[model samples]
Target: MTDIPRNPLIDQDVWTGRLFGGAEGSWYTAGETRDVTEPATGERLTNIGLARAADVARAAKAAAAAQPAWAALPPRDRAAIMRRAAAALERNLEHTAHYVARETGGIPAKAQLEVAEAATQLHIAAGLPLQPQGLVLPSTVGRTSYARRVPHGVVGVISPFNFPLILSMRSVAPALALGNAVVLKPDPQTPVSGGFLIARAFEEAGLPPGVLQVVPGDADAGAAVVEAPEVRMIAFTGSTAAGRKVGELAGRLLKKVSLELGGKNTLIVLDDADLDLAASNAAFGAFFHQGQICMATGRIVAHRKIAAELTRRLVEKATTLPIGDPASGTVAIGPLINARQLQNVDSIVRASVQAGAVLEAGGTYERLFYKPTVLSNVRPGMRAFDEEIFGPVAVVTPFDSDDEAVELANRTEYGLSCAVIGTSLNRATAIGDRLKCGLLHINGQTVADECVNPFGGRGDSGNGGSMGGPADAEEYTQWQWVTVKGAAERTPF
Candidate 1:
């Protein structure tokens, strides 16, 4: 294994303290500290400060105190600050990417892409205030009415480890742009890249103190933020099980919440599709980021006429991809986030193969690294076909017709993402429409995401809320109706 180059620009300070309102330098010493390890090598990276309930309370109070003034600021002025933050992120992109690679086991190239995506999201969010606002309604005689959008007081943002930078900013950027204060809780696994890097960006950008707070900890810190009465809303991105718990707790408290949960996404290839294109898309979608993405291509449904050819091409593509240490800078597949993830993926692959699914390509693991794997003859009852195997694994199932393909794709409880590849655009579009999912692609894989698009899912995936574009402002803010009496003279009681 080649030694990973550590960017000297990043130091221990980047992993040290939790941010409080206006006090960017304040370090929280009241909680227990935990060691963060590199998933690629199991080496101790750094010890991170964990925020407990008391720390959550302090951050919430500070956020609540600062929200009103931030909301009162003119929209353009607030946008200017966000733009400055975007610049700061760009300036520190290399350091942030290094942290992402070191902590999450992402290859340096992909890590850089994540950081660039975050910067783009910040820039996109900076324009939120300039977009159209609430509507003016027709009122009854002698009265005029209009509705105005306003921010939630304080929003709690809980993000997962995979794609930490992009996921965290998906909520944080919109909340801040909509004039809401944020109490962000990043996953313990990637605290420095997910939380601290974000805090430093805003701090350098000169955002007003107390508008943003980052608390890095485990479930205790996450629960603290959710239980904080001062937090009016919660925007969360993680596993469906965790999201359900968050939704249940927030629902009981009557606090607004948006959850971007899991997915057992599918990719369909029709009889008339280009086999090579389909194979390429499937390989990239299933293996990129080691298949840690929520929208990774978990299932592939191919028409019987082309199923065999597609499987052959997929195997050829999957086996050729380089796999090794992420720090090597030459490998395509990196390590899983931890040993548990590695074990879980291995178990599923073994069980699926034992249950009649044929292992076509790579299915072996060396410590945290799992090779890109492909399974064929996968049936509905097989675990690989039904479950979300969040690893570099792709399962292929044969379908007789388009109707059967749609049925197979929609059979899962998760309706997060899907893709249809066919020679005829109209047929592909029709097939895509029938797949019950939030995000769909006509000729590509289920992996593309844009800051300007509504990024979320349906069914067990989420609760009918989105996390990007102008719609996000609506999710993080509320509406108020105002009326003015045109000809009021006197009141009679």
Candidate 2:
């Protein structure tokens, strides 16, 4: 295998100390450090800094101290910072794109798309303050009342490694626009690509010092932020097991929480559906980003009549995807994030074979590249069908009826996302509504997500973030009611 490129020392002049102490706008390296390896070739690309729980505490304290003044700023002024940050990101898109691709094992095209999406979210966030519509109730029984939206004190944003920039920015941009100071803790695996760049943007935007702090670390640091009493809300996106732990910590502290956890999502195709579109969507959803997405369509339920054809088409399309260096523009599939992920995916493939599942196509894990794998006759009881194989693996099953498909789709404890494809719009709609998932797409696999709509799970999949729609924004904030009574007509005790 070819050796990966070494970390360019372009930022050598940039300061390196504590990732948490950057409240003064001067960049600081994170406290603890770890080596980042190229997943495919197992070569060390660079050394990344990792923060500690102490760092998280310090960052939370900084955010708590700065939140009130930042919140007091006029809404439009806060939005102006978001717009400025978006502009800065646009200017540095190449740097952001390259690092994101290299650090996360995501293809260059996907990285560029994520960066663009994040910039768009920032633009949208920049517009929120101008559109804060509150209810003005008419005078009732000789009294007038109105509702007001206000920012929460401090918000803790914890994100995962996959799609680091877009997912992390989705929460941070909105929170900052809403006038809340933020403590952002990105996954250690892609710390610089995910967190440092965000910190730099905030500084370039001229945001008030301490309004945003980047602290990179592992689950321990994440737990610190979730358990911090000063944090008004914990916004988290990660695995179900880890999310549950964070949620419990937040609950114990009585803080509001947003949890975007794991998913074993399913894609359903009826006999009457357009086989071409269904096959393409399923193939991309299952193999794109090496199936690292939280909402990847891992389980495919095709109509019995069309199962054979759909599987054939899916295999044909999936195998054609190119797996290579993530920085290469031509690469469609990329390596798994790390060795552990590759091993985990391989174990599942082995277990599925042992359980009598038929491997339709590639099922080999060579280094970090797990061949674009397709499995057929995956029994419901098999590990491949029951658990989340977060690699380029798709398990296909056949359903004779819509009811049976829905039942199979909902069988797993997760209810994150599902896509239904059928020729009859009414039939697809009925099944889409019936499926137990947070986000449902009819006639398509899970497409790229937008911050405008609520994107999360329904069941054990986990609670969602509060920055999507108006209701979601309200969910993140607290309401203070006011009553103005006539001086002369005050209530007589």
**TM-score of predicted structure 1:** 0.95
Per-residue error at 147 for model 2, in Å? 2.5
lDDT of 1 by residue, 426-475 (tens): 99999888989999999999998988998889988998788898578789
Q: Highest TM-score: give the candidate number.
A: 1
Supply the global lDDT for candidate 2.
0.81
Alpha-carbon RMSD to native, per candidate: 2.3, 2.7
Regions of model 1 farther than 4 Å from truth:
1-9, 17-26, 485-492
Error of 2 at 359 (Å): 0.7
Task: List, residue by residue over 1-493, the lDDT tens digit for candidate 2.
Answer: 2233323311422424346444563556665677666665567656656778887887888888888888889888988999988887787777667767887888888888888888888998888778854677666675668777777788999988988888788888888888788889998777766777787777778889888988878889998888777788888888999989988889888988888888899999999988988888899899889999988988999999999999999889777888787777778888998888889999999899989988888898667888999999887999999998889998899999989999999999998889999899999999998888888998889644876887778667887443475545675566766556665474678
In candidate 2, where is summed lDDT lowest over 10 consecutive residues? Answer: 1-10
Q: Estimate each model's TM-score.
A: 0.95, 0.93
Quote the positional error of residue 198 for candidate 1 in Å.
0.6
lDDT of candidates 1 onward, in order? 0.86, 0.81
